[model samples]
Target: MNSQTELAALLCSRLCHDMLSPVGALSNGLELLADEDDPEMRKRCIELLEQSAAISTNKLKFFRLAFGAAGGFGDNVPVEEAQEVINALAAGNSRIELNWAVEEQSLPKPAVKVLLNLAQIGIDALVRGGTLDIGAEKRDGNVEIVTRARGGKIAFDETIGKALQGEIAPVEITSRTAAAHMIALLADEMGGGLQYALSDDALVLGAVLPQPEGMIG
Candidate 1:
C-alpha cells in the first residue's frame, strides 16, 4: 500500500483497538440492565454505562484532535481545546495523574498535533498508572514539546521509539507505532526533530519544531 493508505489503515486499527474495551463495556452494561429487574443491580449497571460512555467520548475527542482534522482551516488551534481533551483522556484512568503547563495561548496546528500525540504516548506508557507531565512553550522561534511519564512500571515499546526516530520504514508501520511515525514526520516537516529517553520507571518524549516567524507571538 502507499504511505498515506498504509498509515490510515494502521491508525484505524489503533483506534479500534483502543476503543474496544470501553465500547464493549457499554454493550455489556446495556445487556445487564435489560436482563435484571433488581433495583440496586440496575443502578450499578447505569453507573457502569455512564462511565463507559464518558471514556468513549474522551477517546473520540482525543483522536479527533490528535489524528483527525481539527481546528478547521486555521493555522493555529486554541490551547484550551487541546487541554480539555487531554484532561478528559487522563481522567478515564483514575490511577493516572496529569500535569499540563502550555504557556502559549495557541499553537500551530503541527505543534498541537505533536503535543497531543506525545501526551497520548506518555499516558499509555504508564500501564500500572502514574503521573504524566506535559509542558510546551515558545522559545527562540521554536515550539518546545515535552511529555514525561513516571510510574512503578513503564511500557515503552521499541517499535514506537524507532518510529519516533524516523528509523521505521513506511511499510513496517503498525497500529501501535502509527502515531509515533506521524510525530516524526510532522517534526521533519517543521524543520525540527524528536528525541526520547526510557528507563525502568519513566519515559520521556520530546520534539522541537521551528515555528514560522509570526505563528507563536
Candidate 2:
C-alpha cells in the first residue's frame, strides 16, 4: 500500500483502538446497571459509567485537536484550552503529573498541534509514571516547543524516536508512530526540525518552527 493510504489507515486504527476501551466500558456498565438488583452494585455500575464517559470525552477532545480539525476560523487556539485537554489526559493517571509552562495566552494552530503531540510522546515515554513538563514560547518570530518526561525506569520506543526525527522508512510506520511521523513532516515542511533524547529515566522532545512575519508573541 502507498504510504499516504497506510498512514491514514494507521491513524484510524489508532483512534478506534483508543476509543474502544472506554466506549466498551460505558456499554458494559450500562448493561450491568440494567440487570443489577442490589443497591451497592447498581451504584458501582453508575460510577463506572461516569468514569467511562469522562474517559471517552477526554480522548475525543484530545484527538480532535491532535488529529482532526478542531480550531475555529482563527489560526490560533487559546493556550488554556490546550492545557485543559492535556490536564484531562494526565488526570487519568494519578502517577503522572503535568507541568504546563507555556506563558502565552494563545498560540498558533501549528504551535498548539506540535505542543500537544510532543506532550503525548512524553506521557507515553514515562512507563513507570513520571512528571511531564511541556513548554512553548515565541520569540524572534519563531516558536519553540519542548516536552520532558522524568521518572524512575522510564523508557521510550526507539521506533517512535526515529519517526519523530523523520528517519523512519515509510514502510515501517504504523498506527502507533503515525502521530510522530506527522509531527516530523510538519516540522520539516515548516523549515523547522525535531530533536529528541531518550534515556532510561528521561525522555525529551522538542521542535522549532518559524512564525509568520508580524506574528505577535
Per-model TM against the reference: 0.94, 0.95
Q: State the lDDT of candidate 2 residue by residue for 14-79, as single tens digits.
A: 999999999999999999899999999999999999999999999999989987779645878899
Score candidate 1 by TM-score against the native. 0.94
Clashing pairs in 1: none
Candidate 1 local lDDT, residue 17: 97
lDDT of candidate 2 vs native?
0.86
RMSD of 1: 1.6
Candidate 1, 25-97: lDDT as tens digits: 9999999999989999999999999999999999998889899888645788999999998999888689999
Clashing pairs in 2: none
**Candidate 2 regions off by >4 Å?**
1-3, 214-217
Off by over 4 Å in 1: none
Question: Using alpha carbons, what is the TM-score of model 2?
Answer: 0.95
